[model samples]
Every structure is written in C-alpha cells, then in structure tokens.
Target: MLPQRVRLQYEASVLHPDSLIGCGVRRIPEGSTERYTRWINTITQDQLTTQVYTSHGPTVVMPTWFCSRNWFQRVGPFDEGGKGVPEDLLFFYQSLRRGGGVARVDHCLLVYRYHEKAATHSVLEETIWNLRVDFLQERVLSQWESFTIWNAGKQGRKLYRCLSPANQRKVKAFCDVDENKIQKGFYTYEESKERPKPKIPVLHYKEASSPFIICVKLDMTGGVLEENLNSLQLREGADYFHFN
Candidate 1:
C-alpha cells in the first residue's frame, strides 16, 4: 500500500504539479468517522474544491496528502502555531488561494487512526468554524451581490451573524421548509448594533431565490433537504455552496 501510494503520488505529481494529491484513507477503528471517511473517499473530482467550505475541513483528508515539494513550499510553511492550530486546513486553503488544484488517487492507501488523545481533538470546534466561515467569505460570498441562506435555523443564523457587516447586508433572506420559522416571517438581528436593526425575511424553500449558502447538513434530513435542493434544479458551486 505504501509503495502504491508513492507510485501514484509520483505519477500525480508529474501530471498535476500544482495540485494537492490525496489517496483514500481507511480508518483504524474500522467504523470511526464512518460518514466522514465515506465523504473523503467518494466526493467527486469537482467536489475537491466545491466542498472545501464544509465542516469536514479539507475535502481531501490531511493524512493522505501528497504534493510536489515545490508546490508544498509555495503553498506553505504550515502554521507552526503548535497544538490547536489547524495547519493542514490553513495550508490547503492557502494552496487554493494560489490557484492550486485538488485530486485524489481513489485507492485507499493510508490507515487513518482515531484516538481520544489525538492532537486533532485539542483544536476547538469554534476555531475551525471561524476559519471555515472566513474562507467561505473570501472564496464564495465575496462573488455574490446578494444571496439567501438555506436554513432559517441555528446553523444558518449563526453563519449570518458571523458575516461581515457588508456581507450581512448581502443576505437577502433565510429560506426554510419549517412552517413555524416561515410563519414567524423574519429573523431579526438582535445582536446587531445598528439603529432599527436588520430583519431578514424567512421564506419557504420553493419561494426563495438562488444563489444560496446552504447551511443545512447533508444526509441528516433523511433526503428531505436533498429533495428540496434538487427540486430547484440549481447548480452547485454557482447556484449554491454547502456551508454545513
């Protein structure tokens, strides 16, 4: 497996020198991080970039990362900020900003171990959340003049609050299927210091416009969210980007 990984990495490097090439990873405890493992392994080639904003951090897991020395040097000096700093994710984002690409070998070549005392567990979720939000703003949100958020719920509202004032103003509305939230009509920015405050409307998904920043988690809604999203026939990366 190690030799195969090296061979594939070398071939990929020759083919895509400016890309971060990763291979599929199998978790040590078999089922540990099952969904995440499945996601890492199965995401389409385009999703390597499209899905980067998710809580999953890098679409390609860090452990399987293999890139040319020149590309690595160009994109990094991974934050030597010690523990709790997500150096891999920071580097991955930096590479993307530099116009680098992401590719995968599609063969499971590494054993990704999961342990309670792992360094990853030391990093606070808030730290990652803030970073993801920042990257989303830089890469996706800045391109849009205005957009709707897919959920009128907690995660969506949290994303709205995290946006800069300019970006906050760009949020046209919050869209959801929940009758209670839609009946309430709008989400008032109670924490905003603005005079009169901001009250963004909450509407049914079918009534909302795109492009959207979908804050809804995939799979958890038992296909309801997927069904709602597909019903609109909108394109990903352009019409919407998943932030959950």
Candidate 2:
C-alpha cells in the first residue's frame, strides 16, 4: 500500500488483468493496461522520479514533500472550493508563499487522465495572469529598489505601465537593439500624473546599464538577443531577469 501510494500517485496508467493489480483498483481500459503493472513489492526513488516527470508529478510533486499524519493535520485538508477556484493551483502558490520549494520526484505511479474538459480548463486565463503577476511582484520585485526594463518595445512599455507606481519610478531606463526605438532616444510617460511627462531615456543594448528586468522572449529573434547580451559582457543572473 505504501509502495502504491508513493509510486503511482504521480503517474497514472491502467493495469492489465493478466498483470498484477492492487485491491480496489479496477475497470482499467483494455489495451490501456500497462504491461509492467505486475504485483509490486518495492519501488525505488529513481523509478519514481522518472514517473513523476511523466505525468501528474509535474503538477504536484515536491522534491522534499514528506510529512507525518500529524503534519497533515496541522497543514489542513484540501481547499474544497470546487470548480473554477483552481484549488490545486491556489494551494501550490500558497505552499510557495509559505516558503515551499517547487520540486518533483522522478517516478511513475499514477494513471493521469488526458481529458478534454478537466478542472484546469475551468480556470480563467485572466485569473492565471493575475496570479502570476502577483506572485512575480511578491517574490521578485519587492527585493529590488530599481531595475531597467529590457527591449523598450511594446511589451516592455506595457510591463512598465503595469508596474505599481513605486516600481514604475524604479524604471531607470528603457533599452533595446532596435535602431528605431533607440533613435527616438526617450520614452515619455504620457499617463503619469506629474506636471510634465517623465522622459525615460532609451539606450542601445550595448550602451544601456545593467541590473535589467528583461521583457525579451526567448527562442525568438533569431538569436540576436544572445549576441547582444554577450556583447554587453553581462552575466544573466547578476545583470538581469526575464519578465517575458
């Protein structure tokens, strides 16, 4: 029972009648039955870790998630808020909010479903966005007094506008490799309540100072980004973070 609970919780696959099966687990689809479900006595962490990444473990497994029954009582039960609440996602975020690590074991124990209208689809896109933004602001932005926004493009400016006012004032510069935005020299804060629009200087990526919050999306721009960042001699973590 311990082996079953620990092994298949993350990876869910049907087991065949010809193979070994656990008590109370039945009605597995024919041909869907996994060939390897023969009675299991013990399972190793490596096998488990592989399964974890294979299916639901990617969704809920934490590398260091082990608590006694008493601990569970202290941690409380599932948030049974039902559909549209994204109870699982909310719980994961709260775990992180309480200083939990994002982790996963390498195992395949659970038989996960590939459903069309799962609970995940019920959560609104806007809800996810707001949650991500709030988490990002809480986990990262609060630490820095100021940071330059990379790109100076539409997305970058949009992020600047979306930032809380205090964070907005911390935007020291707008930077880009594009000659057009760079040639313009500055981006005016047309929406600010100040008497005059705040003119934030735009600099070529090479010229712009570091400690940047990059709005640049990866795997796009034909590797021009790598070249630009390399030219600046700026190390990634020390000099910037991706907000894209």
Candidate 3:
C-alpha cells in the first residue's frame, strides 16, 4: 500500500460493526512509471452508482470499495479471517453493526478478473448449508409455534435432519404429493433423543395445513410444485415460504 503507487486508500472503512469500504483503483499499465497519474485520471471521471440493502449490507464494485483515508481512520479495517471462514459475511456483519447501509452500484465500474483458483472456492457446500440453516432458524423458525414441511422426499427429510431439536418438535406434519409417502401414514425420526422415536404424520397438501416451510426447489419441480400451491389458493410469504 505505497502512498505514491496507490489510487484511493482508506484506513478502517468498516463502520465499527458496519464494514463499508470506499473503493478506487490504480490502473497501472504493466508496472509503468505513470501508474499513479493514470489512476488519478481514472479516479477523476468514474463515480460508480451503488445500491445499498439497509437490512443486509453494502456492496460496491466487486473489487473497488472506495472510502477516504481519514474516513477509514474512524470506520476501521476489514477482518481477514483466513481459510474456510467467510470473510465477506464477516465484513457485512460488522458493517451492519456500524449502521452502514447495504448497497450496490448497478453499473460495472471496475474490472473483475476471474481465474481458475480463487480463494472463495475453498468454502464447501456443507458450510453454506449450516449457515443457511442457522439463519433460517433465527429469522424465521423462532417466530413460529408450529409449521408443516412441504415435502416428504429426500430433500424435505434433509431439512428436517438439519433443524434444531426444539424446532423439530414444532413440525406438525409432512405434506407431499407422492402417493407412497402419504400412504406410509407417518415418518419415523429414528434419530430423535426422545424415548420413543417421533412419528410425524404425512398428509396430502390440501389435507395438511399451513404455514408451510416449502423445501421444494422452484425450477426443479417442473411447475408441479407451483401448480400445487396455486391449487390450494395459498399466498406466498404469509401462508408459506420457499426454503429451498
């Protein structure tokens, strides 16, 4: 971060809890002497339009977060949690803590270079799963007294397995279109801590009740799931929400 070589730099752009980064870049042409001058020229005319998600966090040009040095002196720096830890999420969390708004610029202001070996690829699918499960429970499941699971298939069962025990008890029933699962009458949770394994009833979508946490993915259903929801005359966000 040499001052002369740098284009725009911030100290700690994180808003204490909100890590909003002010972005700019030095378009140095293959290590040319005029690099800083070129960066200055590039900086003069380009103010990228950014949108913020207040509930979420700020997103600038993928690579160019532009906050001033003095401003960063107050806001702070990014958390560099290496390896599998999600650094972007960590920053977003900190940003929200600092009361910085989440936003993004619609226009492509910076060049995002792609390569075969990016650090982001180090994260596994299961890590994302655990995070999503935790978030869903916090933001949604905690609000409900009870709810129905939309499918009785493998995916639905997988979601059931991932739920917290207290949340698991709140599952009223499993709703499905498959005749075999419905005819099975109930699903046995063989892995439960209770003395007797929990046997959850299976019901037809119309016969079962809401509010449903639909585990079915939209496009994969080939419109069948959509049709079924529509047939029941249920509303989204209120009656049910898509978890998949």
Best candidate, lDDT: 1
Per-residue lDDT of model 2, residues 1-244, tens digit only: 2255544422321222111112222113432323223211122322232221111212343322443344234445657977766565565556445443332233343443334566777877666656655655676677887778898988789778877888788888999978999999999989899878788999987777878877786436777886777877876546665555
> What is the per-residue lDDT of model 1 for residues 39-130, given as tens digits with 9 covering 90 to 100?
88998988888999999889888888889889988987999999999998899999999999999998888888889999989899999999
Full-model lDDT for every candidate? 0.91, 0.56, 0.61
Q: Which ten residues in a row have the lowest lDDT in candidate 1?
A: 1-10
What is candidate 2's CA lDDT for residue 11? 33
How do the candidates rank by lDDT, highest first?
A: 1, 3, 2
Segments of candidate 3 deviating more than 4 angstroms? 1-79, 90-116
Error of 3 at 145 (Å): 0.4
Q: Model 3, 1-244: lDDT tens per residue?
A: 2342122232333332233443433333444324232322232212111212111122343255554455345546665667776566555444444555433222234434444476766866676567656756765688899999999999788888899999999999999989999999999998888888999999999899988988776446667888999998986756776666
Residues forming the 10-long window of minimal summed lDDT in candidate 2: 17-26
Best by TM-score: 1
